[model samples]
Target: MKRFATLMLAFALVLGAISGAQAATIKAKGQWAFDFSWLDSGDFTSQDDDGNSDDDFSASQRFRTQVDVIASEALKGVVFFEVGTTVWGRTDGALGTDGKSVEVRRSYIDWIVPNTDVKVRMGLQGLSLPGAVAPSSMVFDDDVAGLTVSYAINDNVGVTALWARPVDASGNEGSDNNTYDEVDMFALVVPVTLDGFKITPYGAYASVGKDANFTGVTNGGAEFLSGMLSMTEFANGAIDSSSSTYDAWWGGAAFEMTYFAPFSLKMDAVYGSKTADDDAESAERSGWIVAALAEYKLDMVTPGILAWYGSGEDDDLDNGSERMPSVSPTGWGVTSFGYPGSVYRQDTYFGLNGAGTWAVGLQLADISFMENLSHVFRLVYMKGTNDADVIKNNAGVRDAFTPGNTYVFLTDEDSAIEVNFDTTYKIYENLSLVVEMGWIKLDMDEDTWADQDFSDAKKLVFNFVYDF
Candidate 1:
């Protein structure tokens, strides 16, 4: 903590000095936002299946702001900060768990190469693969120190590359599982466009070293590699200094099309593999997922469909592959709504690890109902693709194993149906009101598991977002 403060101080000082030297020209613009709204909080685990059985009708507030800096037309910087709040379902205290209400979410500088279509960014930055727009994504989604570069090949083609050291061996952050000397990550992506559609393919590689993960290594380790292991997912389950560094790789494709006029489509397909670095474990864990969405516009409304399939593990815990493992770092990326069915709201459901699952849903959206209003409604259904029993360890971050993670207790089989609705109302050029609702019911359960039946789940959330 002390080191973080000192580093921030140095950063401010350097920026101040630069401002003094370039006193002539600097451009800046940023957004200041405040939101307030009421919500329906559900206590599914509280034994009530009735909708809105326990609820409050009062509003809540949350705040956020961001600023961008442009210097010399070739150099730029940005900073983003936000505060927490109480809302539907739960409260993390308006004052965050760390007793700090404000956090620096992003801070970075961009430098453009002279006379070329190349730019480089260094400092606290965010990295992600092609599926970043989804509510959830796999590896390297958080903000961290790294170097990212991009080059434009033409109007519809471009390439990007990044290298980042997410964890240092010296932090002692995960003392109990400290088994990495350094965690390094690298990735590259390219986009090719045709007249009607564009396709983007990306790949990433990560490797860890077990050398400086132990005691008595003061000057040899790095610091502040917080939660980097989640990047490799459960594959890094228990860190052991005696084991070799874990290694993994993933590749995927993202494509979008709008050539069909009022029709549009987007899709992502990814595959990943993790090798057991130490001889103690004689097998590898791998998974794959495919998600896609297509919407067509008409005079009054637009209709769409979304579908996804994630592989699951077979009974062969020692060898057979196909478990659609998800590498969730903070469990925030599962933003893509599965439509007809998803166990929980976030990422992964009942059969994420072993014997994968599949979901499909239909969506209806339109903006012609009112002056500045838009609505989206959806219905979905999901279930496990294979009947292989669930794994005890890597069942996703949200729907974790029971008597194990202590964060959640859900031993699920498969089968579910979901209905959801979201509406946005624009109040002014810089203000809007948004509301979202969902209802979920489990269609299947683990007949053999004791007291594992899940209650029906539902939620309603709405907030106003105005900025100046």
Candidate 2:
């Protein structure tokens, strides 16, 4: 990976050299950041759920920059680099001490088809698949290396597609494992706008050629339980972890309407599924996810209602029901270990593909209080759709590296409640300060964990960011 990064940087420099013949332009952007937090039982604490002791606070500081080069009307390129070890998950890279965690974040070039409305982008980059997209970082956000194409259908519509690889297998076969081919992906997205409403619909199809190393279906950030179940099957000694390949797909429509100005609605819903190669595991990979937000705007405040649900693995494996599963590259990323972009904050225990779960919440945002200053608050109620959870158990057994203070603290409880608020102040057009805090408590179904005592968690964070 280091070699590839170096090569890409060298290639971009050469491209810029040749562009001097035309009107070439180069620009750089940079950001410095800091985040400090009071430790909780969540990550840093005096005592862990497993009763271990730790620090009561944490802090992170970093700087990042990106260089943009426009060689011509049809050609452009970008180089991104960052230095820092971050616990806040705001950025992606290796953890470092003594100031050595610096790494390349993105290196991609964009090429436009001459005299046409089409363009092609290749290399390491981030791409957004627009549609009824949820805000869950582990489900909707994706950054990858590969090729992407975008063509304008018209002023109101456009189409985009991708061909990428999420996982690479080195062809090393062992007694229980065979190095498999890389996981390949193909996706198509169409965005359209009519009247005051904008809607994006997308469909994605991905597969693994051979071997069973492709784990998007069973072990992506959202659906870690699927692969876990296959492990529990180990007791039966019938299913080897690498014994099967799978195909998975996602399609959905995202809705947004602003014609009403003060009154608007936003929604994104998708159905995802996974199946054993050749339909061998007929009982797995079926689910749907939906989230909708409606708000009424006032002179200085906005009040909104939020609702969401993501299907989980069914207790009856043979039952004809679908659960939502995210692609491997989706989320903060196995590659980047990045930060959360939605309400499914990384500090929280909720996994996007927990299968049978739902939430209803209220949002109150105040923007009129001051210039460059705003406050947003949310109160949410979360619950399960199933009577009992099988995926949680399966994931519990399969997850060996996760810390007990982290995922293990998540119970079979059927419900939870969380309240959070964020206050932001823009010190300058390019600098901002934010303070975000939250309190989360577990709510359980009497039938699932009748006597278990789950502790509540809270967090207070301070962030300062400067851009240049």
lDDT top scorer: 2
Model 2, which residues run further than 4 Å from truth? 1-23, 43-54, 86-97, 131-140, 171-179, 209-242, 278-283, 317-322, 328-345, 353-355, 389-413, 445-451
Candidate 2, position 207, lDDT? 69
| Residue ranges of candidate 1 with Cα displaced over 4 Å | 1-44, 47-60, 85-99, 132-140, 169-179, 209-242, 280-283, 324-355, 391-400, 403-413
Taking the tens digit of each residue's C-alpha lDDT, what string does model 2 give over 432-456? 8878787666665434443445566
Candidate 1 lDDT over residue span 318-395, tens digit each: 452454333333322222232212222332333222125677788787845778988878787767654425443334
lDDT values for all models: 0.57, 0.61
Query: Worst 10-residue stretch by lDDT in candidate 1?
Result: 219-228
Clashes of 1: 22
Model 2 / residue 252 / CA error / Å: 0.8
Q: Highest TM-score: which candidate?
A: 2
